[model samples]
Target: MTKGLPMRRNTILLAIGVCAVFGAIGLFALHMSSTSVRASGLMPYQDARAIELGKTLYEEYCASCHSTNLEGEPNWRDRDDDGYLPAPPHDPSGHTWHHPDQQLFMITKYGTEKMVGDGYKSRMIGFKDSLSDTEILSALAYIKSTWPPGIIARHNKINGN
Candidate 1:
């Protein structure tokens, strides 16, 4: 009877361990699927309509600082007398293409300060209150569409494409 009791306890523990392993595998699979879907859906830089809409939105909200041609502000790298860095260009001449798509979206929606944290001062303000996620993505797509093929490919690789 004592032997049987120990055997039964061991079997129960083994069963629990199997269940836990399977549960973890299932959760991991679910997470991976959702992540893939989210990543794929976030950027549609190839869609002409999205690019056009993005261009319009950029002109309306961003052109003042970023420039109509996406050339960004003059002396964009230099800090002003107030210690504020000017808006950087979105063109290939600037660093915009260096960032991943998701990061660019976040920076646009939340602004540079929020992403950098730690009392970082940026003249760029969050557009979350004014622009929808789609609009923000569109604007980013428009910026990306202007990049050369090699640059676009590099940016895509950066995003794990």
Candidate 2:
């Protein structure tokens, strides 16, 4: 019995070490899956084709107001002389990442005034008439793709991914 004691202890320690290793691997996998772009909700921002198309569409439709670099007009938070807010930046510096994917999609399709209602004033017009839903999503994906990994992870959390 005394001779087997050390062997038994070694076996127990090995088992515990194996369990710990597997647990760490499982946790890492879970974190990766949760933070992945596909799990972030909405379109696949990782698709290169979609991102390319989105860039084209953004330049054609969004660049005038939002700027080609996603930078909004100067003093974007302030209302213009006409009492309408300038277009906000789509970059990390702006509040666009604060909203979840669905809200962003709806706002893109229906415009801000429609979403806000109650006599709210916004210069943003709906793109439903001009751009297809997929197009809108692609544009949004492109915008999201531009965000850094940390922002992407935070946005994923916001989307409950």
Candidate 3:
């Protein structure tokens, strides 16, 4: 047994302990992070700033089809010459409020063809390339923010409150 053998053992033990402590701290940091839009990784809509940015996105990308006032096309329910459905309103009167927030996010992110199926067709393309996930959520937030209190409450219930 060398005189330094005991010291080496203590040094190894201390290094291991430090590594363990750091690992535990990393896990705690991940757990403590609150940037998640929701528990399920969806968007949080109540932020006023996000809602404002969303309004801009809606005007630039969505207003063409869904209408500037969020009223949608005149014959939204009826199929056009190509038999594709028109963009529906985002207001409480429209079916957009009928779906949960996550579903809404998916539709906006992936577009109708991917979300609905191969057979479905629509002019509303996915904003995945043009906009970030945060932007999509922001636009959705603006849409939801415009709804009436009753509709908003109903949407909250749909989102599991």
Query: How good is model 3 by TM-score?
Result: 0.73
Please give the lDDT score at residue 34 for candidate 1: 37
Ranking by TM-score: 1, 2, 3
Best-fitting candidate, scored by TM-score? 1
Looking at model 3, how many pairs of residues clash? 0
Query: Candidate 1: lDDT over CA atoms?
Result: 0.77
Candidate ranking (lDDT, best to worst): 1, 2, 3
The lDDT for every candidate, in the order shown, is: 0.77, 0.76, 0.73
The digit string of per-residue lDDT tens for model 3 on 14-129 reads 56743553344334334434534442424456799999999999999999999999999886765689967678888876878766666666667667666555355667788888
Question: What is candidate 1's lDDT per residue for 119-152, written digit by digit as tens?
Answer: 6678889898999988999998899998999999
**Clash count for each candidate, listed in order shown:** 0, 0, 0
Better of 2 and 3 by TM-score: 2
For all predicted structures, in order, the TM-scores are: 0.75, 0.74, 0.73
